[model samples]
Target chain A: MKPILPFLLFALLLGFSCSRQVQRIETDTTIDLSGRWNDTDARLTAAELVTEIMGRPWLERHVSKTGKEPVVIVGMVENKSHEHIEAEVFTKELEKAFIQSGRVRLVQGGEKREQIRRERADQQNNASQSTMKQWGLEMGADYMLQGSINSIMDAYNRKKVIYYQIDMILTDMETNEVVWIGDKKIKKFVKN
Target chain B: MKSYLFTLVFALVFCGFAMAQSSDQNPRAQQAYEAYAEKADNSHAASLGATVDKTYEAHDPILIKEQRREDRREFRRQLRLERARRPIIQNNPFGYYPYW
Candidate 1:
């Protein structure tokens, strides 16, 4: 019993010493703990792709031909990566870049657009005649941007390489013409 | 004791020979070595200079106007590609839902 008591004391000390630790880090910091898809990859890919897309000649041509900024709506960004990745995370980043550039106009689409329409319908009855929002006044999007994320992974024993590719394309809604195609490819070599 | 002394002497002789072989004696040889080192430094500088920094100047009115016109035409050509791909969204409320 005396020996067991000393062993228990040692175990408790070891347990306390081995306790997990956590620390807060900056949101934009590049941290690759498990060598998988992470915030850094999403941010870098979105930023680079958006920069390229905005800098392309298509934007200038659109503005010159139409004499106005092109109205764009984000359609979909499908995640087909080897690992589970949230496409929305990067899609929202792309949207943010477009809005921040002040060169493109964005319109609400999908469920959010429907919600706005529903509220406008409710306003038709509840709101005052002057203040009530009119129906059929929604701005139509002239272009749609969509993309897909794909990946290739190769592993040999303790060494592995992961390659991720994100492809985005902007299309003219009226002509169904693809205006621009931009891609971001990230490759990582991990060894254990 | 004899073997230890012999080993020490042998080691000292070998190290002395290595050091003598490494030292440059002739003034011409030393000059040649310095010249080679300078050449290598110059080569490295030239390699660095090969990486030209691209700068755009909008001061030239004619060049800028021509460049802008070319850019617009190129953009129209790129956007006029055949309609092979379609927009991912149809009537779906949510644009794209990830399958976990």
Candidate 2:
């Protein structure tokens, strides 16, 4: 009877455990990731902005189709939202879309470029004569992509309304000319 | 005491299985939702925008409701598929690991 009691208690514990919510693991979830991209909400907003920008036939016409394309770099994207939303998620998606479409040339953005240079320097110094000695190749960006995300929030205690607007502008590196612009917005409300 | 405890455990197991099975269906509905959203944005821009604004004002929970419904359907479909493919266990809720 005592042995049976132990087994019964063990069964109860196991059964209880199954009803609990699954534990969340530390992984990218669209909103919290840094360095590479922003959270999910920001990514969705960015994708919308990309769609808006691509819809502009006039902007497409202006973008030069030189056989030897100029490098394009991602510049600062300001977060003007109510919450600490990852803004780079928009830029990263924009960069990806540009690359995938095979429409524009892209250069390594921000710190990633510097890291590549540093790695190449180390390889050139340590590797033998047969190794590729290329480090910090001479490349200049023709345009810089920049953007911002802004939001407004109105809440009366338990009830709340949120509005998000994301904007992106592409500028000529040499002439400082604004070439293309895109924007996306999202509005959400919560109540109790 | 054992019979009552077993019944409670069985109920809990069934509830848990139901919840897990239902969760799997959300992705399918979500895909449908995305298509609906895109079409709405394209075809009826002004009206859809107004609708979206109104829903956002209320923090639209349509996604949540749809997801729940989807999960239930998927759970049922999965059970049907499983039954068709394999033998059923009639007596035990936890046939393999009863304690757990």
TM-score per model over all chains = 0.60, 0.53
Position A98, candidate 2: lDDT: 71
- Which ranges in model 2 have alpha carbons more than 4 Å from their true place? A1-7, A10-40, A57-70, B1-100
Model 1 lDDT tens row, A1-192: 678998999999999999999999899999898788899998998888878888999899999998989999877666666567776777787778779889999988766776687899999999999999998888888888888778777776566787888898899987799999999899999776
Q: Which candidate leads in TM-score?
A: 1
Per-residue alpha-carbon lDDT of candidate 2 for residues B1-100, written as tens digits (9 for 90 to 100): 9999999999999999999968766568878878988776433222210111111222324445668999999988987777777666567666642221
Please report, as a value between 0 and 1, the fraction of native contacts recovered by candidate 2: 0.00
Residue B23, model 2, lDDT: 75
DockQ of each: 0.01, 0.01
Alpha carbon deviation, residue A12, candidate 1 (Å): 6.8
